[model samples]
Target: MSTRSTDPPPIRSRIDRALIRGAAGATAVLLLTSCATLSSGNGERDNVPEDVSTDITDEPVELTLAYTDDPPSTELVEGFTEQHPNVSIELQQTPFTDYVKTVTLSMSSDEAPDIAQYNPGAMRSLIPSGHVMDLEPYVEAYGWEESFPEATLEPLRADEDATRFGTGSLYAVPGALSVLGVFYNRELLARAGVEEPPATFEEFEDALAAVDEEGIAPFSVGGLEVGGFQVWNTLLNAFGDHEAYRDWVHGAPGSTIETDEAMTATGILTRWVEAGYIPESANATSDDDAKAAFGNGESAFLMIGNWAAFEMEEALGEDVGFFLLPGEDPDQVPMTSGSSVSYTVSSGTEHPDVAAAFLDYLSSPEAARIQLDTGFMPVDTDASTGEGGVLEEINSVYGTAAEQDGIVPFPDFATPGMIDQLTPGVQGLIAGSTDEETFLSDLQAEWDRVHG
Candidate 1:
C-alpha cells in the first residue's frame, strides 16, 4: 500500500515546473496566434454529436484513451470496460513531464485517442484547433452537474479563445479529485498539548507556536518545490477572497494578485518563516523528502494535497490526521486549492457517445471506490469513502469545500510561468531574501506577462 517506492508519477507528486515551463509557453503562443482564427475554426466543427446517448451499444466498439495518471486512470478504464463487455479501451499513458509536451500535439493529430486526459495547458491549443470536444453536450446529456461537483468542473471550462477559464464551454469531466490542506502528526500535536485540530486560523497559529515551544518542527515544507507556495496558497484560501483569486487565475480583465488579502497571506507566511516554523533547509528539500521527514516524526504539520494520503496513511497509520487550513472567520465558507484527474473526448472521435459514456462512468458509484482507494477524492463527493481514516478525513473536508463551490485552481495554474515565479519567490521568502511585497509583485508581474 506504499504509494511511494523510489520514484513517483508527477501527478501523484508536486507539479514539475521545469517540465511544463517551456511547453506551456509554446502552448500559450499557439493560443495567442490561434485567437485570430479560432472563432472561425470553432464553428467549423459541430462539437455536438447529432445523437447523444448515455448508453453504449452492444456492438463491439474499440476506443483508445490517452492518460498520464495510472492508479485511477488504469483502474477506472478497467472498471468501465468491465461494465461494458463489448467495449475495449486502449490506454496510452505518457510520463507526466513528457505528456505535457506531447499531449497537445497528439491530441491535434489525425489519429488522436478517442478519449484523452485533460491538461489545462494542452487545452490552450487543442481547444482552439477544434481537436478537443467541448463537453457541455455530455454534461447536459448525462446530468453531470448533479453527479460531479461544479467546483471540480470549473477549471475544465474555458472561453472559445482559451484565454479566460471557469466559464464558457465545458471541456472535460473529473474522474478523481485532490485538495490542499494541512496534514498533522497526532502524537506530535498531543506532545505539543494540542488536543484537537484548530477550528480557526488564530487557533492554528497558536498550535504552531505551541509545537515550536515543545521543540517540535512546526511544519515540514517542500520549499524546494510546489510545497513552498502551497503554504501561501492554503493561507491565501484561508484569508483572501475566493472569487478574486479565481478571477485572477482565470485571467479576468484587469485582475491582479496584488490585493490587500494577498499581501496579508504573503506576510503571514513570511512571519512563519521568521519564527523558525519553516526550516531554512526546506529550500533544498524535495516534497518526498519532506513527507518522509514528517512520517519520521520530524514535524507536526505538512501542507499538501490528498495525493499524499495513501503513502502518509501507510507510514503513520492512526498517528496522522488532516484538516483544512482554517479561516480567520470561523463562520466563513470553506475554500481550498483543488484539482482533478479529468478526461475529455476528442472532437474527431466517431464514437463520441461511447467515449462520453466512459466519462459518465467516472461519477458512478463503482468508480468512486476506485478513485478513493487510489488516494484520490472521488468525483462523486456524495459517495461513501468508508469508515474513519485519513482518506475519509480528506473526503470529508473536500466534500465540504465542493458543496460550497469553494475548491479553486492551484495558484500555479494562473499562468505558464507562474510556478517559476512561485517556487523561487517562496524560496526567497523562506531564505529571507524576498519580502512579501516583492513576492506578490513578482507574481503579478508574471500574471501581466500572460494575461495583460
Candidate 2:
C-alpha cells in the first residue's frame, strides 16, 4: 500500500550533453591504455585502510550523487538525510540510455560527484582508472555482506582488469533489488480460458496458444531494445544450466554460451515466433510502446522486471498479475536474472566515510520501506510488503529464487557492449533471419573480445 511518485524526471537534454562528453572521453581512454596500467599505482589495490571508519563528523556535510533512477534515489536520499540532519545530498539525474556513457566521463573527471550510480559498462573503465573506490573496507566496517544478499553483490565485484565478476574485491552495494518475470493480464487470461497461471513450460505455451486462438496478441515484446533479449534471458533461465550461464556472465575463463541448453532455449523462442506468439512488428516497437500495449490491454503478457509493476497496477488495477517464467518441469529449481539499482563511491570524494555511510543506510529498515514504496525490492530480502498483491507475488517468487541460491546476473552484463549484440541478434531471431547458432555465437564472440 506504499505510495510515491514513480515518474522519472525528464532528462533528454541532460542525456544528450552527457552522452557527447562521455563518448568522446571514454573512447580516448579505452583506446589509449589497458585498465591494468591505469589502475596500477592507485595504492588502493591493497585492502582499504583499517582506520577508514564508517563514522561521520557532526560538522555539516554536503555530497553530490549522479544517478539515473529517480524514485528510490530521491526518496532514499531523503531517508538518509532525515537520520543525519546535518548532511545534505544533491542528486544529478540522467536518462538510462545516457547514464553509462555520461557517468564514465564524470567518474574519470577531476570534479567527480561524491557518489555515482554503478554501471558495469562504465565500471570496465572507471574501476581501472582508479576513479572509483573499492568498497571492501566499508563493507567490513558496515557488515554489508550480512546486510545485503550475496547474489546482489556478486555482479558488482570485479578483478583489477574489471574482467571477471562474482569474485575479487567488492565495489558497489544494491540500494534496491529487481527480478525479471512474466506479467499477465488476469482478464485476458480468463477470456482465453486459462484457469490459473501456468505451472510448467508446456502449460505456459498452452496458455499462449489459447490466447492467440481468441485473436489476442499472446505476448508483447520490444524487440528493438533490451526487451527482446529479456525474453530470451527468461527462457534460458528456465531451460538452461544456471552455473554455466553464471560463469559465462562473470567472465570466467573459457566460459561460453554455446551449449545444448542455450540452443534449446533459442529453438523454443524461434518456435514461438513462428507460431505468431510474438508479433511480427515487434522489432520496430520500443520498450515503452510494448509496455503501453500491454497496459492498454492490447497484449496478454509482458516479460519484464518489477520496475514495471507500478505502471501495470495503475493501468490494469487488480487485473494485472505476475509470475516467474515456468520451467520445463514444475519442480525445476527456481532461477531468474536480477540486479540492483546500486551505487559506488568515487575515489576523489573528500568525504569517503560519509559516502560509505549513505551506502550503509540503504540496508536499514527505513530505506527498505522507501525502496518498496518506490517500486523496487529491498536489499534486505526479509522486508515485508505488508499485504498481498503483485508485489507480494514478486517477492514470493524472488524470495524462493534467493533462498535456493538460484538468482543469476543478466546476460547483457557479460560484456561492455554485449547489449549491442543481443538486441539485434534477438531481432534477427524474431524476424526469422538468424538461426540459434548465429545468435549464441555472436554473444560468445563479444565475451571473448572483452575477456580475452
Candidate 3:
C-alpha cells in the first residue's frame, strides 16, 4: 500500500507566499539564491531552448526525482530505468503534508531535482521564476498532443503569470489519473430500496431520501477537509455548464462562480443538511474517518474518488459499488472533477532529455499497466481496466469522461487560497451558519485576491 498521507497539506501560508512572490519578484529572488539559475536568453520564454530533442543519452546519466505519491512514482522510476539501463534515477520522497513547501524551496535551490511532482497551487512560483521548464517543445517533438488525452493535458497548461491555466505552455505530463465519484454500500442501498444506481439527478435525490427514511445515515462527509466541497463540486457538475465552470477555474477574464446554477447546487446541499442526510458531526470529521464509516456500513454512501477504491474493495468486497454522480439530463455527457499524478521537468536539471523521456514513458502501454496495478487510472486510457468490481467501474466511468472531453480540474485549482475558502465555507453550510451566497462570495473573494 502507498504511504502517502491522505491529509492535504496545511496550504494557506505556503500557497499565499508562493503566489505573491511568483506574481511579482519570486523569480528574481530565486535566481539570486540558486546556482542553477537560467540565463535571460534573448526572446526565449522560460529560458527553454527552441531546439528540443526527444532522444536520451545512451551514456551513463543520473537524475533525481522528488515526489509524494509512491505506488506509481517508485515503480515508474524502476520501470524507466529498466528500459534505459544506462540511466539511473535517485528517488527522494516527502510526505504529502510537507511536499509543497519542501519541493518549492528545493526546486529553487542549487539542489533541485531533475523532475518533481507537480502541484498547481504549491508550485505556481516555479513557473514565473523559470525554475520549471516549459515543455511545449518536447510535446511537439514527441507528438504527445496526439497520444495523451486532451482533457488530461488541459490542466497542466498555464500562462506565464500562473494566474490562469487550461491554455498556454505545457508544464507537466500525467502518469496516472483519478476521478471523483460516489461509493455506495450495496447492502445498505438495497435495504433502503435503491434497486440500482440512479441514472438521473432527480433519481439520486430520491435515493438519498429513501436511505434517510430507512434510518440510515445517507452520506458520510469529511467537512474538515476536501470531502465537503467535493460533494458540492459533484452537484455543480450535474447542474452547471461545464465550459463556464472550466473557464472560471482557468481564471478566464470576467469569469465568475456566483451563478444561478451554482446557487441551485448549493441549495441542494442545504436541503440535504436540513433533511439530516449529512451527519451533524460532519464538520469535525476527517476524510479517513468518513471513508472508514462508509466502509463499515455506518453510512449508505460516500462521495469521493477512485483513490479510495483499494481500501473500500478490501473492506466491503462485493458490498461496495461505484458510479459517477448522475447529471440532470441522463443523456448528457458525464462531467466530473479529476486530477493526475503528473510530473514536471526542472529547468535547472542537467538531463532535460532524460527527464522528458521519463515523462514520455508514462503514456506507454507498459507504464499503463503499472498505473492500473498501483490503484490509479492509467494515463493511457486505452489500456484495459481490470476484470471486475469497483476498479473496473471507476475506469469505465473515467474513460467515458475522458472520451467525452468532460473531465475538469478540481475547483481548488482556481487559486492557491481557494481550498482555505472552500473547506471553511462548506463547514458553515453543514453547520447552517453560512448561507449559499456567503459561501460562494467567500470563494470569489479568495480568487479575486490572487487573480483579480
Candidate 4:
C-alpha cells in the first residue's frame, strides 16, 4: 500500500524517529526499539489492509498467532506456508463461542504471539502499551499503498502520541471485510411461505413469528459471554446511533451508546427472545454452537458475519442462502466491520527484516485467499480475485454499502471491554433479569468499571 500525503503531525514525528533508527536488526530487541518510535501514521488511508513460523531453533524467531474459528484462518495459513516454507505458524484457535475470551486474554500478556488477530479498538491499547510493533514505516517504505486499501487501512492507525506510538501508525492489518447478513435455509423459508428475504424489520418479525410456530429457534445467539451481545450490537451498529458508536469508541463528544436508539434496538432483541422468536436456552449456546445451529437448520435466521459462509456450505451442502439484515436505517450502509487480523514483528522477533517481510507477504491478497476463507472482502482493492469465492459473493450482495461512504465499525469495535459488559447485560435483559432501562444503566456502569 502507498500514500500521497504526509502523516498527521503527531504521527509524522513518530515516523521520523523510526527512520532515524536506521537499518532493521536481526536481533529482536533492537528491532523493537525502532518499531516503538512510530505508532501512528497513515491515519487517512482508512480501509487498507497471516502467519507462519516454521522454525523452532533456539533462536526463537517464531511468529505465534491466534484466531477464533473462522474458516479462512486455517486455509489462508496453509496457503501462506506453501509460498514461504521457512516461516512456521503456531496456531491457537478458539471456537467462535470462546473466541473473544481467547483473544482478549492472550493480548494482555508478553506471551501474546508475535502476530495475533486483533481488532481496531485494541490497536490503541497495544500500541500505547508497547505490546505491538508499529508497521507504519514498513507500510510506507514498502509502498503497501499499492496493495492496501485506504479505507480499510485507516482504522488501525493510532496517532494520538508521538513517543507512545499510540495512534496514526499501522499496528495491525485488516484480516477480512466482515459483513452482516441474515443467513437462512431456503428450504425452511420456502416452507414458511416466505420465498424471499425480508427487506425490513417488520417483515423480519413476521418471519420469525412464523418460524416460532413450528418450535424452531428463529434466530441463533450465543448467550454465554459476548456471543449473546453481538446479535444486539450488530443491530445497533446497523440502525442505532453510529456517531455515538464512534464517540464511545474514541472517547469523543456526546457518546450515545446509552441513547434511546441503542436501548430500543437492544429492546427489540429482548422482545424477540421473550416472544419465543429465539430459544430460552439461547443464553447457553456458544457462539460457534449458535452459528452451528443455523447450519443445522435448528434456527431459521442467523445474524452472522460472512465468515459463516463456509460453515453453512459445509454443513448444508447447497441449502443456504443469504441477504442483508434489513434495519430501520434504510439509507444507511448495511452494517459491517472490516478487520485486518494484523501481523507484527514481535518486540522479541530475532529477524526483524525477515519477520517484516514475512508479515508483508501475509498481508497480501494472495495470502488472504488461502486463509480458511474468512469471507472478508479483500482490503486490496486492485489485487486479483481469490478462491474464497465467498468473499466475492458477499461483495456482490453488499457492494451497495460502498455508496453509503463507510460501513460502521462493529459495536465490538467501539471500545475495548465494552462488549464484555454489553453481552452479559443484554443477556440479562433478554432473560428478564434486567429491564431495558436497567440494561442501559448496567451497560454504562460496566463501561465505567472498565474505563476506570
lDDT of 3 by residue, 296-400 (tens): 889989998888887788889999999988877899999888888889988888777778878998998767777777778889887875478888888889999
Candidate RMSDs in order? 8.9, 9.1, 9.0, 10.8
User: Which stretches of model 4 miss by more than 4 angstroms?
Assistant: 1-116, 119-126, 129-131, 160-167, 210-217, 329-331, 347-350, 372-377, 381-392, 398-405, 449-452
Off by over 4 Å in 1: 1-44
- Give the alpha-carbon lDDT of every model: 0.80, 0.81, 0.81, 0.56
Q: What RMSD value applies to candidate 3?
A: 9.0
Candidate 1 minimal-lDDT segment of 10 residues: 27-36
The top-ranked prediction according to TM-score is 1
TM-score-best of 3 and 4: 3
lDDT of 2 at 362: 86
Q: What is the TM-score of each candidate against the true structure?
A: 0.90, 0.88, 0.89, 0.71
* Count of backbone collisions within predicted model 4: 58
Q: 308-371 in candidate 2: lDDT tens per residue? A: 8888888998999999898988998889988888899887777777788889888877777777
Candidate no. 2 TM-score = 0.88
